[model samples]
Target: MDSLTQFTLGAAVSALCLGKKLGPRKSALLGGILGTVPDLDVFLPFDNPVDAFVLHRGWTHSFFIHALATPVVGEILVRSIGALRESRARVWLTVFLCFTTHAIIDAMTVYGTRIFWPFDPDPVGVGSIFIIDPLYTVPLLIVVIWAFFSANWTSRFQSWLVAALIFSTSYMGLSIALQAHVENRAETIFADAGIDARNVFAIAGPFNTIVWKVIGQEDDRYHNLYISLFDEDDEQARVYTHPTRSDLTACLEGNDAFEKLRWFSRGYFGTALQGGKVVISDLRMGLTPSYVFRFAVAEYAAGNVRSIPPQAIEGQLTSLSDDLNWLADRFVGQPSVRAAEASGGEPYGTTETASCVERQTSG
Candidate 1:
């Protein structure tokens, strides 16, 4: 999720926990700052672009690490902050909640977070919500702001903070339910089309949960669809099928960087050949022609593919305004053929090749 949402969430949880001792203003400020601590890993140096991309939200966001550090952080606060001196337990709870909630919410988005960390390095991504959702953040933000400027922690203010927390948590639950509903619908549609449902997954579209973008994978092809809750029961979703280029996977086998991406995407990925270079696209994010992470990892040479250091490719959005317009229309169940039409071109573009590895032919 975005930084603002995390800040507001931390503020709300912290204010609720320590308001009586520290006052709503001070508690909220402390919590908001602590909430952003886990994300500090973004500044850490890495050997390559792939490591930086996949290693974010790692150890710092781990639940185990947070649990182990909670007491240390709380003890420091209790000793240094006069008002919190006698409230060791509450301070601990505040620290734990602020850090854990930040990680939990981040895991809710399509971008993966390694909440479990060392015990389990695999990232957890529910893909139930977007990275930014105003509906989820606004209520928490409003209540936190009210509490921030309040003279004291009155009973009424406390109630408002609690209500906001409840509302936001419930909204998160709702998104999970909606994601399941969308996945179910997509499975049914896929089954009807003679496509397997084993690899089907749905993610909220952009900033809203009312509509979802679902993808179903097969060995050689993948299907994409947009479904809105407002659509009639009998309405048939427009499905767009694209090639997976699964055959090319063998060409880049044993390449460390390529394998890391395959693990990150959890098999929901595709291969592309652009100007004789091999590109890998994470199929889980962005639209059909545009993707969030595409890497040019290898290139064709004399009928063979040779591995190279990974280079992250910037996804091109031909028109942001037009894409948003389509999203708006699709969100309301207004079907259009634009997405289908947009699917008819080569999805990858040419990029400069990097140097490395022995040549290997595609099997």
Candidate 2:
């Protein structure tokens, strides 16, 4: 989720917990600031991009860290605000709500969260909602702002605030339900195509949940689909074969850097030989033709393999202009077939050669 949504959420929660005692305005301000504190780990130093990616939402976003920090921050609030000096416990609760809600909401996104932290560094994600959705934030923001302006924390005002929170939370439930529906659709599509899908993952489209993107991974290929819930006809599936490897993985089987990337992607990756280089592309992000996380893990020579330092590689672009336009169409519950094709919609891994691992065969 974006920082604005997190800030508004924190503000709303704090107002609910301590609005009356600390005044609505003060409570909102305090909560909004504290809510954004957990994300400050982005400034922490890291040796490499892989570490940076994996370390994000680690210790700082952990529930344990927030829990421990709550009392400390609450004490500062208690001392700073004369009105709440006597209400120490309520102040702590207020801080706790804001801080913890940030982690909880982040866990709902596709990137997942390490909210449990030291217990396990595995990212816990629902994979239901996209990082940004106006439907989730706009309505809640309206009500939160209204609550902030109200002079008193009257029962009616509190009811309105709680109702807003309920609506937003329920939207998350809807996202999950829609994801299940999409998975079933994907399975049926794969079945009809006579493709055995080893794994299938569904994610909501860019900004809205009405459109879903499904990826079905197989041993030799992957099927991708963009389905609009409001579409009048069944969506067509696009098939893309995995790039062929010439004993690349067999040679660098246990290379350290590649192993780390393998773990990070949970094995959802594509391999290609570009310029005689073996690159592993993280399939979780970016569309198939243009992925965001490709790394050159090894170099191939004649029949030998040598492990090299991992280097970030960029995906090939079909056309930037058409890609943006087709993306916009999908966001609005409609897709243009011509635009899709022009925008690298031919199938997955089409451009994943030359600059990708299959480059060795290129002229």
Candidate 3:
């Protein structure tokens, strides 16, 4: 989830737990600040962009860390803040709830989070929601804004706050259910097509979960299938192929950072030659052709593969403008049938088959 969502969720959590005692204004402000503290790990230095990308949601977002910090933060607040001194235990409880809610909400997104920290450093992801969804954030933002402006009427704000939380939580559950339905359908479709793929997932596309990008992984290749809730039951998926490579497998396999990235992506990544460099792509995001999280993890020089510190070029890992319109159309404006028909039955973001473009090649 985006930072704004976390901030607003924290505000709701804080206000719900402390609004009656501390008033809405103080609770909202305090909660919003604490909500973002966990994400400050972004400033931590890393050897390369790949490393930073892989470990972005590590121990800092862990529930274990938040649980340990709660007492310290709570005690400091209880002593320093005059309003909270009388109710030390309640203020501590408020801090724990608001802080932990930030990390828990993060775990619900496709981007993984290390909620367990040292016990389990691997990111725990539900894949139930997109990283940023207006449906989940807008309602909570309204409640937070209302609390900030209005001084009194804490009880009334509390009612609306609870309502917004229920709605957002319910939406997350609905996304999970939709994912299951799409995966089951995708499984049947693959069987009919004779694609011997066992591990498959229906990932939400861009803004909404209704339109899913189903991926099936074999040994050295992945199959892409696009399905939408709006289309007829008989609508066939537009399948795309992406080939995996081991061009410099020996070197990349030995690198600790590369292994971490592989684990982070759940092995749904591949190598590509981009601008005469060994580039890695996280296949989960963007469309088939134009992916967002490309990184120049190594350089190829003099017909030899040389390991270089991974670097991400612009318009790859962080660009949103390129896919914004497509996401909007796929999610709301255009019907899925039109998109399937408009492509003339060809998979979008593909060149011939994935095999030709992504075949194994030497430097």
Q: What TM-score fits each model?
A: 0.93, 0.85, 0.86
Give residue 189's error in model 2 in angstroms. Answer: 0.6
Q: Give all candidates' CA lDDT scores.
A: 0.83, 0.73, 0.72
From the highest lDDT down, the ranking of the candidates is: 1, 2, 3
Query: Residue 125 lDDT in model 1?
Result: 93
Residue 203's lDDT within candidate 1 is 90
Model 2 Cα displacement at 280 (Å)? 2.9
Per-residue CA lDDT of model 1 for 1-363, tens digit only, reads 999999999999999998888888999999999899999999999877788888988999999999999999999999999999988998999999999999999999988999998999999999999999999999999988997797588999988899889998999999999999898888888888777756789998888898788988877677778888888762557777777665466767777778888999888887777666688888878886688888877876555678777788776566777777877877777875544235543455432233334543321
Segments in model 2 whose C-alpha atoms lie over 4 Å from true places: 147-156, 233-235, 244-247, 274-277, 300-305, 328-363
Task: Identify the runs in model 3 with alpha carbons over 4 angstroms from their true place.
Answer: 248-251, 301-304, 315-363
How many clashing pairs per prediction, in order? 0, 6, 2
Worst 10 residues of 3 by lDDT: 350-359
Clash pairs, candidate 1, are none
Per-residue CA lDDT of model 3 for 222-242, tens digit only, reads 777777776566345556665
